[model samples]
Target: MPHTPGSYTTSDLSRKSGDIIAEALRHPVTITQRNKPRLVLLNIEDYDRLMRQSDARSAMTLETMPDELFGEFETAVGAYADSDEAGR
Candidate 1:
């Protein structure tokens, strides 16, 4: 299912909770309080998909990197550490 961002007030949500949740299955719904956005309603699948994407983006294994590239990385880290110490 495809979804677009939609905003709703708390009172509005309270009155139409079921419908709102149904809509959330298709897209994220922003809950507002005092006319300001506060919380989001979304399907569990959407939540899981987002978490998976985050994990994929953060997946890094230095051990899998080429030796030459990793060597340069080590050198860069050493340089950065030296610079940080100098700044202290």
Candidate 2:
């Protein structure tokens, strides 16, 4: 089940903070204040995994690119097509 931060008040955590940290170690703890989620405490492994996935997604978005260094891609494609037709 997803951890519910609202289930425990700040006082509950402050009084038994070690238990809270231990629980967070097992899974992320969604910490809330004033009934809104304010923080997520995750173990190191999970945080690292999330960061790696974000980096991979950013890399994938940069892979496909136009050939021209200074002009629109349509101009590049049209130039290529015109050259091919002339050669034929």
Candidate 3:
């Protein structure tokens, strides 16, 4: 379930569960029990997108990337410095 920006009591949900579900499909619905938020309902698409974004953010390797992957950048910089010195 996705969590919306506001709180909805369990009783409120019991009374309007269908509407709550529809709203959840569009965004997220926070479910509260005992005045405390307990769950969230999110649309599948939103959930998938969030998961993918989180995975992308957590995935990393550029800093630890093998030198071969960025050797061209160093080579290009070296060439530029050499050319600048020759021009001077």
Q: Quick one: best TM-score, which candidate?
A: 1
The local distance difference test score of each candidate is: 0.84, 0.68, 0.79
From the highest lDDT down, the ranking of the candidates is 1, 3, 2
lDDT of 1 by residue, 36-72 (tens): 7889999999899898878443445897887997899
Task: Point to the candidate with the largest lDDT.
Answer: 1
- Per-residue CA lDDT of candidate 2, range 24-87, in tens? 7888876666666777777899998899878543231223654453356567789999999999
Worst 10 residues of 3 by lDDT: 55-64
User: Clashes in model 1: which pairs?
Assistant: none
Q: Give the TM-score ranking, best first.
A: 1, 2, 3
Q: What TM-score does structure 1 among the candidates reach?
A: 0.56
What does candidate 3's lDDT look like per residue over 1-88, in tens digits?
4434655778878888888888898888888887677888889999988988784434436687568856876788899999999999
Query: Which structure is stronger by lDDT: 1 or 2?
Result: 1
Model 2 TM: 0.53
Model 3's TM-score against the true structure:
0.52
The reply for model 2, stretches above 4 Å from the true place, is 1-7, 55-88
RMSD of 2: 7.4
Error of 2 at 21 (Å): 0.8
